[model samples]
Target: MRSAVVAALALGLLGACSAGTEPQTGDPAQATAAETPTMLASAPVDLAAAEPPECLSDGIAYATVGQDAGATTVAWAGAGDRGVLFAPQENGDVCQWSAEVARLAGAGYLVATYDWGASGQAGFQAALDVLKATGADRVAFVGASAGGTLAAGLADDLSAVAVVALSPPAQYGDVDARVEANQFTGPLQVFSSTDDPQVPAADSALVVRNDKTSIVTEVSGTAHGIEFMAPDGYHAEHVRGTIDTALSQGFGEG
Candidate 1:
């Protein structure tokens, strides 16, 4: 069993830490939208100069859409032919992404992964590269934990695909930070449990969209990391179901 125990700094804004402070490895470099030169005022992305592509995980291949001109490098499996992308909850590395890649690959999807740009905004920047590089006929964003935040921020970018976020923290910005449901243009299906102490269910309730049906699963006695850290893994069904639904809608699959 590949242990999901990654460097503590590898996860989402909320998964590994408490309110206000986010855990990051290496020197903490902060960049605001203004400091981003490659990005234009017209788009949330710059798409001008791309970060040089490199892989931080073994077994996961990385490639960019443009020749380092201005696109995110996509992390993907070169083998499977199914159209699927799995982003692990910010629990750590491509740890969970690896498992899901194997799972969906086995289930017959040409599964791919995009680096979440694990170091800083550079990581998020890489994630954007992965998406643009994919050349996917249809796509879906399956975000786990902190990965969900990137998925949410990429909603406009991923508009062509469906988004399935597991254990989406109420606020990617803060603990007490209430995400006005308007924060996302979601046909978003959020996964949660009653036993979760790390992220409260109340937060998800606030951000849930009233337009599409909001399905919240309150699993008793379960906490965060339910699928990756469990025996029966009650969360897997929700995970699978959400991905399947998104893909079906994404590709117009029946």
Candidate 2:
């Protein structure tokens, strides 16, 4: 059943990609010489030279939440009442989540990604507000490393339907994820690598509340945090597929 759903998603993505490439119904031979020259001069240039391709591609739209040093830039796409918010690892930005964002968006969920700004948790709250303002009622939080810690710590407080943490530590700076995990009763999933030097699987497991709805999975490798989500990372397909399934079920879309 999972494989069938994945295949259907792939077909949908292919259809979306091909939808814009239908052949034009005009003949160049009938174009006037003046109109031809104007058309040539107005052709679009390569946008990659001026901006990151991920920010511009995949139908993404950008918006800013908060102000001043607390401001966080958000990139989002897709549209639905079900949404997913991605939080980046420490010292990273939303660009790290580009692939995941596109994947979730294509899956028919409104997906949003942002960098944690100076306001810390407040910035993330603002991003959540942005999602809510955009019509998302049921949302999930997915984060990596420090961001994962934040997601675990804030999920219950923010009323998130689900939370997924990748290589999260039991505690991150001022946030105590273990305590939050103990308090949150919603579905929580944590992923870690057995050999991750920054945070071992045993350490990541500490964030599990031991509730029937919570689970921790340890894959054999040294990759940490967002590395697990990269296309070529260890067991990336399995990890991503598991996350997608979890989100679908948690958000009542399964």
Candidate 3:
């Protein structure tokens, strides 16, 4: 577990404190044709020229897209042509500073996160569109909570390099992760804690595809969503290790 101060700060923007701030609008993907292309023209942030805030990790360049759609932020690190899209928990904004997201950026992979604008699948699809347009040789998905369910449900359509879902439910609205998981053949990593109150370990297990490449890591702590990947939070290293391993093994393999 993180220290009291760290835990409080992390939780502040994750969900508990981020209500009503999220935009309630139509899907950004459905924006005007002119707006869609502009959002996809992602440019890299020059980290060496400008200093990143203390909240964001060093070595990673930052950028944004989908402002017209719903504001999608992207962080890039390393030299790999592969990219990873990170989806936050329910009610969490993609623009918020997150150490876990920063770490993924630092690992030398192109990373993207975005606001869904309450458009559900459309919002998620919009984020994926931006990632694919960036010219990345390969791409993957990582999400927590509601974002996790979305990732699992759309993995097949996205043709993701792999997927890593933390504390996710088996379904989100009409999207069933279990049904979608059965069709995905890539490496899938699902993390769950037996102590999580919001999502039971059993519910998380419902996503298991029972394939040789699928893995469900059950831990003892109660951290859910992005907290599960916080450096100072419980199961942080495990989350990082899983992503690192999956990216190395699955990224750009095709």
Candidate 4:
């Protein structure tokens, strides 16, 4: 009987995705099932039919980092050392991930989302430090637009396992982000679309590498920044696969 209920919820979620409505997320603390969305574009082929992570059943754990005047940073807690630091595009709100954050947490990853409290580097480093303070050993970064540019800059400095930067430009505003990509020598994935008017796909061409595996996915449409990360968006399944791949590479499967 319980299994029947979960299956019904799954079907409902699929319908929600098809109709462009937000999935109904009940209180995690009260949830008794691991309800996850169906694979869209980027879900791992194998886990395409697997049960959603337990985070769907268990609510997210919340915390804060910096608190110096205007430098307050917020973080959401998940359940593993495989940490994901999400950097937003220009002036993007940190609270944008209230829904999707729990799904990633359910998948056994420690996900942190924050605003740029100080300088891009300083703010990001502080968030990384906070995650490390909690004993996270292996970390991956998922940045959007300018945020992606920042993540690329720190790939080497932080020795991160993987980076997934979407729509990152050669120069963020006037800052030259190319230097960061030049120094990085790890698994990198850059996602861009030809239809993106603000950032041309050619901008990703500036990501030069020496001895690293660089995967550049030039999508055909205009999905940018967090749009690629959305569950119902064009690259939803692909984004899930990307994050899962990063986790597997950073830490072996359990």
Candidate 5:
């Protein structure tokens, strides 16, 4: 029973390319889970079927994107002198983050979305790994709940990219401290639905900026998971439009 469990766990930990740099995140490989070996000689994660589609983004030809190490499948799009990456909800495997990816990718930027932790449940150090692996000097983090945690954590690493959060939970262990202590001088966008009770609207209230930060964007809606779970027929459209505006402006300068 132990051996079987270990094997299953080992297969899971084979992902997540690097360790977390957060003071609270000690040896991200040790963050959580049943303790599995990470650096194995086994072949890279087989995610060939999940390669980013070769789609045209705003008339630009962008190569399909996928991480070689950690073997994460990122649905990347767009091409330009610089790169832009889009992280999925926590692990980047779910279909919910697809619309967000499309918005970023279609805007003539190199956007990438991938899985982190294991599946979508565990994602403490994923943001840093994804940004590092993609070589995206500029990035934008988007997600709800745990996925939102990943975005806030990476705000320091990709200090250059615009960081956006929608209905991000308030209690995230020490990760919250990192956001508080760090300087997000770039474009920062945060939105919390006024109707959601599970997460605090105060998350949208906390804004950190330095001399360089030119914009702090905060929007409010009446739904949960605006990017995905919103039930209204136009909810997805609202998310799509909001994303379009955010990415359009956020990706341009800040």
Candidate 6:
């Protein structure tokens, strides 16, 4: 019964794509199940068959990273030597970063986002491989919450030019983000809300490296992860502008 339901959903998504339907947009937390795609347990679903989200409608393309059971769905836009890879929060999906991805791509930077599925770090690595293969020699990592933790943990090893973590915890799963941040020498920005119910601002501060280039910004509300960057987020303008400046500095465009 479950498999049948999954198949029906997949077919429906494909139909929507074929019809050139415009994807609904708003807060990712409020996105309906139909607007978000999930992985199938048995086989990889061809997410590319669906129309890219409305934000990606301009010139974005979709692809599958990795293969077989490890395959993950990814969407990308723009083409340049500099790129940005977005890692979504644990419960979030690619659409969470749609607006930001479109904005960055419009600024002439390659941008990509993906569904993590069950592959975790491996899935993220594969997405990075896609970015490299598509002509990005320098890439930055941007993530939210759990994804933020992973981004900081991998930045040093991945040679990321900069990393932005929105409401990241000190540790997530087995990854010790604090340690990883300590080891990273590049620019790092960590943002969190003072009253975030999940992880307190102080806890998120633990992920900030001791280097001069690292800093943590705490806002007044309880918005978590990607919420800080949402179009209607409490501190959207300030947060977004700060991030833009950081990205420019990291990419040598400042």
Q: Which one wins on TM-score? A: 6
Instruction: Tell me the spans in candidate 4 whose CA falls farther than 4 Å from its real position.
Output: 1-58, 61-64, 117-119, 173-176, 179-181, 208-212, 252-254
Which numbered prediction scores highest in lDDT against the true structure? 6
The lDDT of model 3 is 0.60
User: What TM-score do all the candidates reach, one by one?
Assistant: 0.59, 0.75, 0.69, 0.68, 0.56, 0.77
**lDDT (tens digit, per residue) of candidate 2 on 45-156:** 1101112234433345444555566666665556667878888888777787877766666556667777666755655676576566555798899889988888888887
What does candidate 1's lDDT look like per residue over 78-195, in tens digits? Answer: 2222355565555354544655554444443445555444332244445444433333345556666666554544554545355665566756643221235344454566666676
Ten-residue stretch with the least lDDT total in model 2: 32-41
lDDT of 2 at 226: 91
Report the Cα lDDT for candidate 6: 0.70
Candidate 4 lDDT over residue span 88-201, tens digit each: 776764655545455555555666666565555555766676556444588888788888887776677787877878888877754555745356666777888889988888
Give the local distance difference test score of model 1: 0.45
List candidate 6 stretches off by more than 4 Å. 1-55, 179-182
lDDT of 3 by residue, 1-254 (tens): 11332333234223333111111134322211110111222223211112233444333333433445454444333323576777777777554424544444444454556555555465566555545544456888888898998887788877887888998899988778995445888888999988998999999998977677788888897888787866467677778778777777676443
Each model's lDDT: 0.45, 0.66, 0.60, 0.59, 0.43, 0.70
- By the TM-score metric, which is better: model 2 or model 4? 2
Stretches > 4 Å off in candidate 1: 1-74, 78-83, 106-110, 114-121, 174-186, 225-231
Our model 6 lands, by Cα RMSD against the true structure, at 8.2
Query: Candidate 5, after superposition: displacement of residue 226 in Å?
Result: 4.4
Off by over 4 Å in 3: 1-80, 95-97, 179-181, 252-254
Rank the models by lDDT, top first.
6, 2, 3, 4, 1, 5
Model 3 residue pairs with clashes: 77-108, 78-108
